[model samples]
Target: MGTALGTRSASAVIGVEQSLPSDVVVDISGALTNLVADVFALYLKTKNFHWHMSGPHFRDYHLLLDEQADQVFAMVDAVAERCRKIGGQTIRSVGEVARRQRLKDSDVQELSPGAMLSELRADNVRLREFMLHAHALCERHEDVASASALENWIDEAEKRIWFLFECSRN
Candidate 1:
């Protein structure tokens, strides 16, 4: 007798024979999951800063954070989708995100506008570094699709970093 999906045995699972080796997919997805977590964390932080921003530059800073938050949030879905596309498990919950994320959470107290900008800038730099490392791993595994996605993400992060740095200057 055959299994439900025409498999002769019960051992075979769907998507088990992905184009990329399972190990490579697992490794790439792990990296992408971590990136997703960080992006989510940053998204929340940017929103926090946006909501709490004040002072003479309130409008400018608030709008900047809002736009940045949107950009960060946009990446989250792509990262998770890419992980699933490669036949690997994605982050399942907020706890999973916290466990995988490398970004630090901000304090409940509102930070100064400059302080917020600086912290976000630093986090973006870190995210960019992680993306570069992931890109290299993708290349090593010949995962061109993942590598291409990372390239676009890296460019976006770099622009964010540049804008944040400019905003931070006197």
Candidate 2:
């Protein structure tokens, strides 16, 4: 058992066969778990913004967030599975996700459409940064598969940020 990300419960170390060292597996698993948590957090926030979206651009903004939310959600399973494939267990509960998540949650009753887009854009940028950090870790550990996976995710995050930035602009 080892600490999974920053969460309290010790993650059950699995016996998945892989060439990487145990420390590398633990590090990557913790990093990927954090990424998964952030992805889930961002997914829900995107949906929240989509559901509550209003104003002159309601149709367009709503559709955009809905699409982005789907894209964001598409990331979860791949990342979680990557953690497991690399010889560490993935997240098992919503509570685990909440404890490991690094992204901020929104609870505002009202927000301008611009504000929502801006917030999501910022979050995507941060997500990209987080992926890059994990990528760097993979690089340092010579974990080619994990690094390659993070590259695709980083690209997706860039696309999301681009869309949100363009949409939020006046």
Candidate 3:
């Protein structure tokens, strides 16, 4: 098969190149890769909170973090796959994720339950912002499938933010 871009895979007898413009693919893939890194970082942070939760509300908080972490993790594969579908590469290692992630790392050895919730809520909000930008890029490129996927991700991130906000409220 011939790629829409007329580029042939070096190792494949028959392979198709991406149909999207190179610049659009680069932009979308870069955005998605950054989103993947942020999602992975957030997943680890949520899991850390889930494991270290301590307080009268420990059980509830732990369960919430676990659920939220699972949701964040679920986005990783989809984002990477989307990059691949566009004939772009994604983060291949933890170091790459670290380099690309925009979310700041939590350096405190201990964080209060409220602090954990607040931090996660903020990060989710940031992730939603990135998703919105990526969605716009997809729209500009007429990539409806990727745009639809981003819409779903944006909904998920918004729900997480709402839940975290509610949980943090006194």
Candidate 4:
């Protein structure tokens, strides 16, 4: 079957000279591509909240989300390139990202600081869950490099969740 990028198989493109089977590469790359999508979704939502922030804690909350957004955006390239490194194609368009992203977009006209942080915390929790599953998939396939990357990403997601949780507390 064709993959999301409309490619028949991951190894059909230029070979990356890996020992892993084509199916294994395809599975790991698919999981990583999904991570890239969720990362993009979360990054945009963080920026959206950052731009629309208001209230007494505006400065603190705004800066927090801005920093988080930057961190989240930094993961995209590495994840996408990881797919290529494993002989697979990553996301090619925003449409693919949107289609694969599991995070819900927040488009409410306005959101208070607490609501913003809480929503973000929930999303980050979900992101961490996704990463853990990807890590497990890597382990199952003996993809140590991808698993290592996922471990760091999982830690980053946990930190984001903790920060958002603490910030939202009264």
Please state the error at residue 88 of candidate 4 in Å: 0.6
User: What's each prediction's clash count?
Assistant: 0, 0, 1, 0
The TM-score obtained by model 2 is 0.89
- The weakest ten consecutive residues by lDDT in model 4 span 1-10
lDDT of candidate 4 over 53-94, digit per residue (tens): 999999999999999999999999999998988888899999
**Candidate 3 regions with alpha-carbon error over 4 angstroms:** 1-18
**What is the lDDT of every predicted structure here?**
0.86, 0.88, 0.86, 0.88
Clashes of 4: 0
Assess every candidate by TM-score: 0.89, 0.89, 0.88, 0.90
Give Cα distance to truth, residue 13, candidate 2, Å: 9.6
Q: Per-residue alpha-carbon lDDT of model 1 for 44-86, expressed as tens digits?
A: 9889889889998899988988999999999999988888887
Which residue runs of candidate 1 sit more than 4 Å off their true CA positions? 1-18
The residue pairs found clashing in candidate 1 are: none
The stretch of ten residues in a row with the least summed lDDT in candidate 1 is 5-14
Superposed on all Cα atoms, model 3 deviates from the true structure by an RMSD in Å of 4.3
Cα error, candidate 4, residue 106 (Å): 1.0
Candidate 3: 10-residue stretch with minimal lDDT = 8-17
